[model samples]
Target chain A: MKRKFLRRVVSGLLVLSVVAAAFTGCGSASASENSSKDSDSASYRTLDEIKESGTINIGVFSDKSPFGYVDENGDYAGYDVYLAEQIGKDLGVKINYVSTEAANRIEYLQTGKVDIILANFTVTEERAQEVDFANPYMNVALGVVSPENAVVTSLDDLKDDDEVIVISGTTAETYLTKNYPNIKLQKYDAYAEAKTAFENGNGVAWANDNTEVIAFANENPGYKVGIASLGEQDTIAPAVTKGNETLLKWLNEELETLGSQQFFHKDYEETLLDTYGADYEETLVVEGTK
Target chain B: MDFNVINEYIPLYKNALLLTLKIGWQGILVSLFIGLIGSAILYFRIKILKTFIGIYIEIFRNTPLLVQLFFIYFALPKIGIVLSAEVCGTLGLGLLGGAYMIETIRSGLESIPVIQRESAASLGLNEMQSLWHVILPQAISVSVPGLLANVIFLLKETSVFSTISLMDLMFTAKDLIGMYAKTIEALFLLVVFYLIMLLPISILGTILERRMRYGQFGD
Candidate 1:
């Protein structure tokens, strides 16, 4: 009788666990449907509504250095963060910074998790179809960095057996996968991991935005941006949710107004000057006057 | 909601599921080997080797698998030893899973009654013979349930290998999400895929546990 009871209990628990897993799976399915419906049905808050609420949600990277990164004091501080603060100040609302990764920027906007994304988001035609990108504030392009001892200067320089390091979900990954199908690529999920992997000689070179690779090469002694441009030049801009015309217009106006004040130049001085030096200040900063 | 999105990515998901299973089984085998070695060292109570095994268990168990993976894949290269991402992931999982396996097998060895050893000695069996011909067989049988349970745990733990870019199930899910932006569909499929892999192992564990219990007390 005891053995029968034990078997019954075991079977019962197994059934219960199976039920729980199915429930969770279905629950998430419904949850996403609800969220999508919520987004479709007047879910977005307007600029005026945000101003009235006295808060604006801004998404920025907490890991990507010199653009958006957490400082030693654990506060988010970077070029993008500096611009976010300026936007918050100008709009007269408290900024609530939401930390985001590269891959989740559009999702964050679509889900209304953040009102704007300032996460070194490069404006691409494909992305523009999903999110409304504001006027460009900075220029960027894909670049490759390798160890000084054996710098990868061009696509041809890479051996057939050599692998290039890329962060998953980045343009560099997409670019290289499309262009250099024959080359092996070692993709990492995070910038820190990719950096470490590159340092460890896991790949012949690391590919990322020129701004990032430049900064990385400048900071790390033995690395250089050998292939300084791998793909078409692009501009980094803040993106608002699709059909957020009011926010998009306001951001454009703000960028134009900030341009007259040379705000991006000042932003460069404050955040990027130490890293990129003065020469790149003119080339990298977008005036946004147009 | 859009089941079509998941249906569309079936091919990608299938490939990723295969990779995940490949890594999961390889990790299990490697960890089992390490576990057997670790348990044997502790079973014999080798003085210096015991300390080293203790340190190995403590370090791998005390730290996170993600950090250990990062160390092997990223940090070790700074000192000159470079390994592929999959190799680093498997090694990390093996080391971590082995730590837990050691304790499980140790308890199994411990549960073998002292009388068995005494009987072996009386039967004129030496230490090696007793361990080889007598103690290990029973102890390993006792350990079967725990070791299988650990294998299941390690199977799930292989998801963490995605961080190092092993193209496992979770990484494929992330890649799908990145491509399609259908977070729920990708995640639900990921959960279902994991269930497909894990449910069988869990059922096996239960059967082994029941069988081992029956063998132990003859209910």
Candidate 2:
């Protein structure tokens, strides 16, 4: 009798838990559908719509510097942030900067949390399926860095037994997985922890955009960017939610005009040149409008 | 879009889950050893070891595991104490679990009536034999439940080690989410994975505690 009662109780609890998980699943689906319906048809509000609304939500990284970072004074300051300020001025709309990570860039735009992601967002074919991308403002190279002793000079040199460390969601993860399928990968989500792991010999090398590689190699004397450039030229571009043709057109047009003025090249010289030194200016610079 | 893709990724996820359990099991063994040995130290009231134990317990108990993990992962490597993520994770848990077990078992030891010890002394048993034969046997019943709960907590925390490339379940889930941008599916599955690991031990701990509560040990 006691065994039967306990069985019933256990079965009842299992049923309750299944129902609870089902309820949560439904809740999330409804939430996702609600967000899609609310934002999909609303689409691009255009420059006039933004000026009328009085603010443009510009998403940028709060950690990456010379691109987007929180300054010592708690103000958002970076090359992209400087451009955001100018864009706001030209449109006569207030700019509301939203801090975003590489992982959340597409989702931020898709859900209408931000009008655009300018957070050093490297353009990739996989990401393009979800968001509309503007003309490239800058060209980025892929690079790998390792401890001074275990330098990874090229993809060819890395042994099959070795694992490459990566910040998941970055262009590097996509490139490495596609290009070096046999090379094992030890992935981390956050920059800080990944850096710590790399320093502690968690992996043979760390791969990321060349800009980030340069930053790490310069800051940490014990490490070097042994593979200075890994793949074909990759571009960093502004992006908005897919199907937002009006916004994409405006951005592309502005980018063309910005290219003629050599605005992005100048932006790189002023902000990135000092961090990178003068050697990279002509080689790495890509002035707006791909 | 392809749910079938999960089949391809299953090996990675399964490997990660197994690693987590392995690390958790090792941590539990270390915790058991530490608890047993620490209780002996405290029960015997050793000279300097008691003082050191007090300090160690207070320090670990007062601080956060996240801070401890950061220190072990980063600071140790700085001073040339290089260890892999898996080793660093197990050692960190062992150290923290030892400190926690010290306090837990101390309480269980104290709860044992002194009358039994006095009677044992009269029966010509030395202090060491008295503690071994009398105190510990009874205390193990009480200690098992807390240690089991601690094991569960340690299992969950193995996820943090994933941040340092420990290849645990949470780490795999994060990797998949990053790869596919399928946040909801990955996160829900991770919670289910954790529940599966923790629930059986929790039920076993409860059963053990109840059995210990029967007439002979109840008083």
* Local accuracy of candidate 1 as per-residue lDDT tens digits, A75-154: 99999999999999999999999998777777888778999999999888768867889999999999999999998889
What is the C-alpha local distance difference test score of each model?
0.84, 0.77
Off by over 4 Å in 1: A1-49, A243-246, B1-8, B210-219
List residue ranges in candidate 2 displaced over 4 A. A1-58, A72-74, A87-100, A104-115, A147-150, A219-223, A241-257, B215-219
- Candidate 1, DockQ score (0 to 1): 0.33
Per-residue alpha-carbon lDDT of model 2 for B1-219, expressed as tens digits? 234655666677778878988887887778768877887898999989988888888887787776787888878888889877777778778878888888788888888899989999999999989998988777766676776777777777787776566778887777676666655556656666676677666666666666775523563
CA displacement after TM-score superposition, residue B34 of candidate 1 (Å): 2.2
lDDT of 1 by residue, B1-219 (tens): 566776887787888888878877777778888888998899999999999999999998899988898788767877778787778877888889989989888988899999999999999999889988888878877888788878888888877886787878888777656544666677777877887787767766666666776766664
**What proportion of true contacts does candidate 2 retain?**
0.29
For model 2, the local distance difference test gives: 0.77
The weakest ten consecutive residues by lDDT in model 1 chain B span B175-184
